[model samples]
Target: MTAESDPWAAHARRTVGGPRPLLTEALELLGRPRRRVALDLGCGAGNDTLALLERGWTVTALDGSAGALALVQERAGVHRTRLTPLEAGFHQVPRRRYTLVYASLSLPFTPPARWDRTWRAVRRAVGVRGWFAATLFGPRDGWAGEPDMSFITAQALRERLDGFEPVVLREWEGEIRLAAGGLHPSHTLTVIARRLSR
Candidate 1:
């Protein structure tokens, strides 16, 4: 899709700043790793991808929008060699293990019909003792009933992370400004979990 018509492109343009706080926290939890391979799932404008690259992690920036991938490449500069841009939807995510699987605000956009499979793939992608950090929308979010989007409850989220050890699982609700430019009621569940086994 053209950058003008792509919502992700606009989002990338608007969110052009530092890496996400959850990501920073996850990194701190992981300390220094022996292998620095990471997957930036739904990696919009490469905010987290750039952060991973800067820290010497080989990152695969996955996104569905060509415009978003282009922006990632443009911003990668010297880090481009360590960055691999994959153009595909969430359902098509590769089932390969990585030292880190970081999905910022991307999991909420996965369609309900595809969530189970997508999530399973995501879970499998995390290597043993690897980190998985993501933000999922709760049922009270403004976009909760958008048909295609998936929203979860605290209990459900905990159930989903059954095999993983939770490092950070915080839930909060409030009015927040949207990237598209409007105040909206949002309930978010931020999680940083580590795969303990298989």
Candidate 2:
């Protein structure tokens, strides 16, 4: 199913566009790990997916938006066999394991009430010694209390990822202007975790 048929295509379009700093950092960290299979959750616009491909990663780009996939399909130099586009939400991904999983600026959209369950699914999807890079909104973020968004305290987030070793925990706080228009002060927490075991 393409992103055009998906109802959330517009929202995804507004959510992501260009390359993000966290995406660059993730690529740097993956160089030594030699990650081949990657899952780019909420890969809107394919910026991150294309980045992964350039890094020689075989990617499964998942987004609930069909427009997002269209954007990916239009990207140059990426082979069709190297990239698999799946228009699916976090909850509906096919059960499988990945060597690397990046969910940039996407976890906040998960329903708070089920955030833990969703996290568990993410944890399960990343294989042993796999790398997981994701962006999560913090309590100080303006969108914290917004509907369908999940925000957690630093301590709470630390506890949630107790089983994994956190390689990077950079707290980003500043005002960002969206391309669509509007500025909001954001408190973003970027986490890079390595799954050592179950």
Candidate 3:
């Protein structure tokens, strides 16, 4: 599909406002990392990537859409030197250690069959003491029944972070604004956890 018509592209355009609260809270908890490196998984439109760059972080912004990556680079401007844009899908994510791995409102898009593998890659990408912040959809979300997407209960999500120390774990169920510009019933889990062990 064309970039103008792609739903993801449209979503990216709408979400360029600022970084999410999960990321800000995670950064506050993390303080100054030994290494100022971060991986912006599914960095739609580079909103979070720009936030990290402004804080002097070397960011790797990964998105499946080339158009999205272009937008990231464009928005980065002078911060482009610190930004590494990678165009790849969740299943194609490489295992690379980083001080922080942030995936906002993206993991749920992974197909159920690829969820385990993708989650493993994401987990391994976090170095010891590193932080991970993400927003995951719950089974009650409007898209939960779709076979191409993955949804988890709050308890199950916590179980998956076996080696991580929970910093911020919040779950909410109510009407949420959609990327395409409307309201919908949604259940989401937002987490910022620190990896305690390898």
lDDT leader: 1
**Candidate 2 TM-score, C-alpha based:** 0.88
lDDT of 2 by residue, 1-198 (tens): 544566466655665556788878876776656558989988887888887777677889988777768768777254666998897778665578898889988888988777877888888888888889998888899887787888877777788886788889888889988655899889988899888887
Model 3 ranges off by over 4 Å? none
Which stretches of candidate 2 lie above 4 Å from their native place? 1-18, 76-78
- Model 2, global lDDT: 0.80
TM-score of each: 0.96, 0.88, 0.95
Residues forming the 10-long window of minimal summed lDDT in candidate 3: 1-10
lDDT for 31 in candidate 2 is: 69
Candidate 3: Cα lDDT at 35: 96
How well is each residue in 1-198 modelled by candidate 3, as lDDT tens digits? 685666676668777889887788888998987799999989988888999999999999999888788889999999999999998988676677999999989899999999999999999999998999999999999888999999999999989999999888999999977767789999999999999999
- Report every candidate's CA lDDT: 0.91, 0.80, 0.89
Per residue, candidate 1 scores C-alpha lDDT tens digits across 1-198 of 765688788788877888989889999999999999999989987889999999999999999888889999999999999999999988777878999999989988999999999998899899998999999999999998999999999999999998899989999999998777889999999999999999
CA displacement after TM-score superposition, residue 108 of candidate 3 (Å):
0.2
Ranked candidates (lDDT, high to low) = 1, 3, 2
For model 2, name the residue pairs that clash. 2-66, 3-65, 3-66, 3-67, 4-66
lDDT of 3 at 110: 95
